[model samples]
Target chain A: MRKPKLSDEDYPTTGHEWDGIREYDKPMPRWWLWTFYATILFALVYVVFYPAIPLVNGATPGVLGWSTRADLAAEVEAVSLRNADIDQRLLDTPIGDLGADPDLTRYATAGGAAVFRTYCSQCHGAGAQGAKGYPNLQDDDWLWGGDLEAIVLTLKHGIRDDGDDDTRFSQMPAFGDILETGEIDALTQYVLSLSGQDHDADLAAAGPVLFEENCASCHGETGLGEREQGAPNLTDAIWLFGGDAETIGHTITFSRYGMMPAWNTRISEAQIKQVAFYVHQLGGGE
Target chain B: MTDQITEPPRLFEAREPVFPQRISGWYRRLKWRIMLGTLAIYYLTPWIRWDRGANLPDQAVLIDLAHARFYFFWIEIWPHEFYVVAGLLIMAGLGLFLFTAALGRVWCGYACPQTVWTDLFILVERWVEGDRNARIRLLRSPWTLRTARLRATKWTLWLLIALATGGAWVFYFADAPTLLADLVTFRAPFVAYATIGVLTATTFVFGGFLREQVCTYMCPWPRIQAAMMDEDSLTVAYRDWRGEPRGKKHENTSGDCIDCMACVNVCPQGIDIRDGQQVECITCALCIDACDTMMEKIGKPRGLIDYVALSDEPLERAGHPPRSIWSHVLRLRNFIYFGLWTGIGAMLVVALFIRSDFSLAVTPDRNPQFVKLSDGTIRNAYTLKINNQTGFARDFHISIKTDEPLRVDLEGTAELNVTVPPDGVLNTRVYIFAKPEFEANRAETTPVRFWVEERAEAGARTHADTVFTGDTQ
Candidate 1:
């Protein structure tokens, strides 16, 4: 091998000097130059093959014709295709029979939870904890019933809604207009006594006769509150509006009416079943 | 010493291109074996299948970024449990420190991917274009059709090796067989192709072309490794006490070196060992093999260039026996590093065994902290996330422990028992209603805890504490 001259005087200078040093004007390594060229070639080919350069009107559609939107659509399509079978099973299976298959149960419950968050969580809280007028779905106190079938029916027809003819409808007469104030006060004492709460014994004694005469048909003789009539049980500590003496007196005098919108016309059948199944699984569902 | 240090680069000086001659010895064989073992592990680990039950992936070692899970042979890591991975990285750092203190740059020489792949590329180059002399001749000669053909063949082989190197890396993130098929059919995801493309270009340029420059300049390990090595650390060194004052032949008249330049020709880094220790030396010990062969040819003692500790140089020059390599390797510094490395390893193992597969995390709703129900009851909402890390689906019963009379109510169903899918997270919206008395005597915020228990598995329980915001009294 020939030894390269290391002396500054022997080197071919580029006429650039600083601090008593001269530049040699040595060529870059051949392999390094070729690698640089190879990178440029690769970039040119990549530009031609992939969507890269932007034009005045729009981006250039390269040979590969890849678009981010199309890629996302394809990914979404693939996921749906994989889930198609489970979705179909959810639709075919009865909401009552959903608990029989664990896998299907899981799928429906997950889907139902999502559906509830979208639709049912407005009036009812996101956790299905009902507001003042709305029925708290988490409690054992169901205005209609708490069973899976009962929830399904309620979800379909709603309660006292004007749109649905089959909606559960009930109304208490405005006792303030019908009876004297003394009579409404006595009835509140009678209602409080049934729940085993503190009340005036003599007032309750006089209140039962009026309660037996006015509320026996739908509330039952024992005040268990018939599910068919959607009347809340007065014997339990739970109350739809309020269980206090004043509120009970006001409820009896002016009457209380709660309305729920039917979801059959609003949401799909699958979604209705899912939400019903979801609500039934809540701890309050019997 | 003055000859050892080069002055700052002159404006007119040209870089000396390194063209290392091939050599073989015990160290070379050891290097070849390590390269084969490391490369095999890298290329084949993702293909090894482990039956992870029905719903989970079967790859033995995988990083499932989509699911935020990492699976390694029997061990699985969740996103929240990334501390184990961090602990492992710390152990690796300590291990590097320990190994570097005992044996200088052994990791760089034997185990580093840059060293291993560069060696492989050089081997292929030698097989096609012949060894050092022939390659130098080819570089010096004028361009010819034969030389162009050889160059094309060498570059194509290098490209294929680089492609395979990159191809094996992507398999760790996905199912090996399925991704391989997808890649072959041009149906793989864009990220997969993009990753392979970037890695391919890097491997080709770094392994096939840059070679030793990666160790000397690009990598930070070599600099860190220099700090780890001490006077007692074993490194490839010339026995200059005997080999110096070189180039004479008569008995007792000259040193053993003979100024043959064999050591320089055989060095991958192309630095002269006679110039003393420099940061560029990787301690590959190939120069030792080369010098030993020359010594054997001249009927002189081998080991003119051999593994030696710097502290032993004075003793050996005074004609006293130097310390053994075992004595040099087993010192206080190495012992301390080993102790720290193993201490973390032991702690990690203990934590792994004690940790529960099921975990509960509660996030209380903040927007409307407390909602007053129709019956004059205050309700607080929380989003509960239950993580089931078991291989099979499990039923977890949710309950709460609080001093206040709080009723736990999950949104979906009346059932307290929730079936969490295998290796999945179940998010349930929960509403806790305070009793009438509790609501009447409310605090600004009440501390509450939500607990989860695996129904079938005893002792598998975890809980999360969250604040239940309520009306101030």
Candidate 2:
């Protein structure tokens, strides 16, 4: 090959020139040219292997015959298969039994977290930190017992419920009708004294006799509450309703019965047990 | 030094291509305003907050894929109502067509992703390598270290822009705050990273490299827009009657013509409007601003290049009275498009109004079709799936309605009370047994209705109907 000479006559140029500044008729870059050809080849391959070309009725199904719908179905099937063992285990094991296995417990907790966020998070916060009316699951203070069995029972049969028979039943009598205002005050002071709160010694001494008459049937002699009766312990520092003097007086004057909903018909029995364990492991569960 | 005088460097340098040094006019200012406004909106929308009660996402525009819900300020879309997304896509298409018919290719010029990205890329190019003339000189110059450095800087800026574009896109799919945290910690979901990678590559390829080619050759909108346009539609045009018999400045004795090529240089699509309208022209009107500036400088009146309707051009040429064709934009074609668009919108609204919170589906147990009881009662097994789309948990009271005195039996519980968790579905197997007398009275195929009533809310009810088949009566 001979070297080309650099001469004005040898160069191809645009016919028009401004003050001898000529435009060279150079071809496009080789890389750009190759890229163009490669892209056309890629498009041909893509059309042959994918649903690219539109036909009269529907798009052309490629040699692979793959579709977005099929891909989605396959993905769903894969996920389902991955979770099948855990799902089957969840179906087979009793909710109470779920907490015993750490793996199942982890799975249950994750599942319960999603369920709680969707269902219970409205009343109870997303973190299960309850509002004024809602009971906080993170706290140790539970109106009912905090064991898995107790929580399951509570979920299965709601408290003060009219429908189911096994519901936790407690009816504090209207002490307002039975006792005078002064007597109610004495009783409230007496109840507060059970938890070592300050009270009039003479009034508390006299209130013992009043307690034996009306409240001793449900609450035991020492003022520790009964679980079966759904009566709260008076001796404990944690209060379900409230511990203030006026609140105690109001409770005596007009007995408050807090209603807990039955979640058994709504959530699975196992889920209730899982939540119970989750709550039981929280600071105050007994 | 006096003997070496060089004729004052030939008195004038060669006029290089420099975008014809066009002055910014109304259209150019409008384009700048739109660019600034759109960019501001896009970058700031993610941070706007809307309180959606407690425990719900606060972002005004959120696609909570984890929750399978989309929240747009006051509106919330559930997964089951994905048809809303389909409706939105249809509305967008129709809106584009409407805008195209009224003012051709306006979206491609002002709002399209290709146009926006290409404009951004061009801005970066201008910042680093200077404007059109400087770019051409830099390309023609021999490979120097300074030129290489400038090229490198431009590419870095372009890559950064492409990355930012990709990064902003993933924020729409998840909670922007959480995803940002996860991304920083390298704990983002695999899908998020994969999506960003794909988007980054596409943005770099299409925005930085492909640029106007995406609009001119790749996009299908220009092809579709050709059919949508009519003679009365407004388009950027060259008034050849006013500008032809073109010649250089001081030599323009014919038809007020000046062969400056200002319009050609300022055109983003690189098309000559004087050659008449072509598919590549996005109608950006940079050319209008350029030509207007040139006309003003040459002591000629403006609108040698202007927006005009094809229908009025012939009439004006024939010396007939110019008819106002703005009213023609609302012709039969537009009316039909509007009708269909409104009809779809109205149907979606009505469907939204009638949407139910509770749904019931029945699946007949195929394994054992019918179980013959000891008391000669015919029994059929079925799995009833109940979906509660409400936000709160509901206590469902299930009852069977049949032609005969059919008794419903649950596997474990005596009461047919089901509690469906909020926004959840429950599948429970149910057994229906007919009394012997009722079985004797029943036909081979009997229709049975399963009704679910929410105890907490009395109004919420759903029903599923299925046929109970028996072996030889």
TM value for model 2: 0.61
Where model 2 places Cα greater than 4 Å from the true spot, the runs are: A1-33, A36-286, B1-23, B53-56, B64-67, B366-369, B439-441
Predictions: Cα RMSD each: 7.4, 23.1
Interface RMSD of each: 9.4, 21.0
> Against the true structure, what is model 1's DockQ?
0.06
Sorted into a CAPRI-style docking class, model 1 comes out as incorrect
lDDT accuracy of residue B4 in candidate 2:
36
Number of the top DockQ candidate = 1
Per-residue alpha-carbon lDDT of model 1 for A79-183, expressed as tens digits? 879978987888888777898987887777777899899988888878787776677786667778889889988989999899998898988788899878888
DockQ of each: 0.06, 0.01
- Clashes by residue pair, model 1: A132-B374, A281-B413, A281-B414, A282-B412, A282-B413, A282-B414, A283-B413, A283-B414
| Candidate 1 regions with alpha-carbon error over 4 angstroms | A1-81, A160-182, A212-221, A226-229, A249-257, B1-17, B36-89, B152-205, B238-259, B295-304, B311-323, B344-473
Q: After superposition, how far is residue A131 of candidate 2 from its true place, in Å?
A: 57
- B47-134 per-residue lDDT for model 2 (tens digits): 6788864556778888877878887776777887899889988988998788778788889888887887777777777888887778
